[model samples]
Target: MNPERTSAGPILITGASGQLGAALVKGAQAAGLAHRAVQRPAFDFDNPASIAQICAETSPSLIINAAAWTAVDAAETNQDAAWRANRDGPATLAAYAAEQHIPLIHISTDYVFDGSKGAPYIESDQVAPLGVYGASKEAGERAVLSTGAASMVLRTAWVFSAGRANFARTMIEAGRKRPELRVVADQRGTPTAAPDLAAAILRIVALIQRTGWQPHYGGIFHATNQGATTWHGFATEIFAQAARHGETAPTIVPITTQDWPTPVRRPADSRLDGQKLAAVFGITLPDWRDATRRVIADMLTQPASAP
Candidate 1:
């Protein structure tokens, strides 16, 4: 490891197989940073022993946690699994980081906010999650902070990438099969591109290693693409971009949240304010539309059964 790098040991990135996790691994390699990307069985969130085993094996200088129980609807029925992945798992990782005096970068979600505020939420906004998934993630945030380790919690929304089964790919596949699709228009938030987020995270990591951990670095911050849009709006754009890539476009109908019933309640408007990220780290993701277009373009180049 380079002495000028953040840690003398390699950076350990959890959730190495997920969308964002894969992106981070790519970004780290592109930046020529030494990193160890580990996922389940070896670093399974449900198995706390896996967490300790991996940390001990790597002896990482820094850790970036991208692991979580991300199935929103399933979380309602599988609360125990959700808690294990989103809350207890992260709590275990944070505790271990604290014990080793390693700085941690943990990923969070915008669902922590109830969305009743009717405005973009900031770092200090009151969090009132409506379902098990959101509540569990919020609990993990609190757990990480309570450990008093040098940590940064990034809360993002609507993440997608060409590498995983995400919204953009789902819409594309659905459009290819159906002539029309109904999407929720009442729920609104920024659509973040996984690669863009991964890039921003790596930049932060380099800054921390170069400058050392600063007093202002250990806190929560909103990190997403530049703007917000409803699920309907996002789907429409996805099909529009898909059309430009020679894929068939579907008729997307806007529907209210009530039109689509699910096991858990989602926030109507969970747009997060990302100004703090720009102010503190001088980092901001690309505009949502641009990021969406890039992801769609990348997806179009892949085979139909890429995921």
Candidate 2:
């Protein structure tokens, strides 16, 4: 996509109902990127043919794939369905973009890593996914890269958006209903705000176009809010922040990952080192807590106050 032609042609955004997708639409408008967003039945993952058709019809210079099968546990038994959406959907989109030679900005998850490393995972680190969701996302990343679609795969973690059914929303609901809440403390990672991440996505496309970057130039990059925190610690911050906003907050009881005994195994340390995104895209992300504060402020004004 040419940065010069940005003002006229609308940007086609998929998964408009999701957190990241919604943020992209808002960000695009604010940045004067694009207004056209494709959602279910049109851009839905269940129908890959329809998805391809939408890309062809819109012919957007830039295509952002913000949709994915994000149900971590459900993916354990539903690997095929997950692959259909996560892997196959992007593969199809990538192939089309390659035929049209357009640029794509696809959002991915930090779950793609197994989290065995002691430090933050850099883009060059070896990937060893521990579960179905992670495996699917890893596969999708490969497909996007292999398709030669001039795509940038941004892997993020612990996403919490004010308008989505994410951690922050659940915390508010549970904190209000229960006097105390139990949370897992073993997993550690950054909490990325949808809007901040969305801004980074736009910057990636802009940087690539301005530099005459090629398809080989496209690779995996981590674009998450800085710093890391366990789910328990994250919940604590959310509750504390809510209290500051005059909302009732509950005590978060920290527990081990095993204590909570979930069906799916979560990465123990999903923190990603975003040096590559910073160096290549020329963008610096805010701290995770600061991003959370912005989300909480926006949540306070939400009429439905829901995800």
Instruction: Report lDDT per candidate.
Output: 0.91, 0.82
Residue 262, model 1, lDDT: 87
Q: How many Å off is the CA of 3 in candidate 2?
A: 14
Worst 10 residues of 1 by lDDT: 1-10
lDDT of 2: 0.82
Question: What TM-score does each of the candidates earn?
Answer: 0.97, 0.94
lDDT of 1 by residue, 1-307 (tens): 2222355889999999999999999999999999999998788987788888999999898999999999999998999999999989888988988887888899999999889999899999999999999999999999998997778899999999987899988898888889999999999999999999999999999998888888788899999999899999999888888878788788898999999998888899999999999999999899999999999989997786443
Off by over 4 Å in 2: 1-8, 214-217
| True-vs-predicted CA distance for residue 212, candidate 1, Å | 0.7
Model 1 lDDT, residue 190, Cα:
95
Winner by TM-score: 1
**Best-fitting candidate, scored by lDDT:** 1
Clashes of each: 0, 1
Residues 224-297 of candidate 2: C-alpha lDDT, one tens digit per residue: 99999999889988877777778887778889987988777888998999888777666779998899888998
Clashing pairs in 1: none
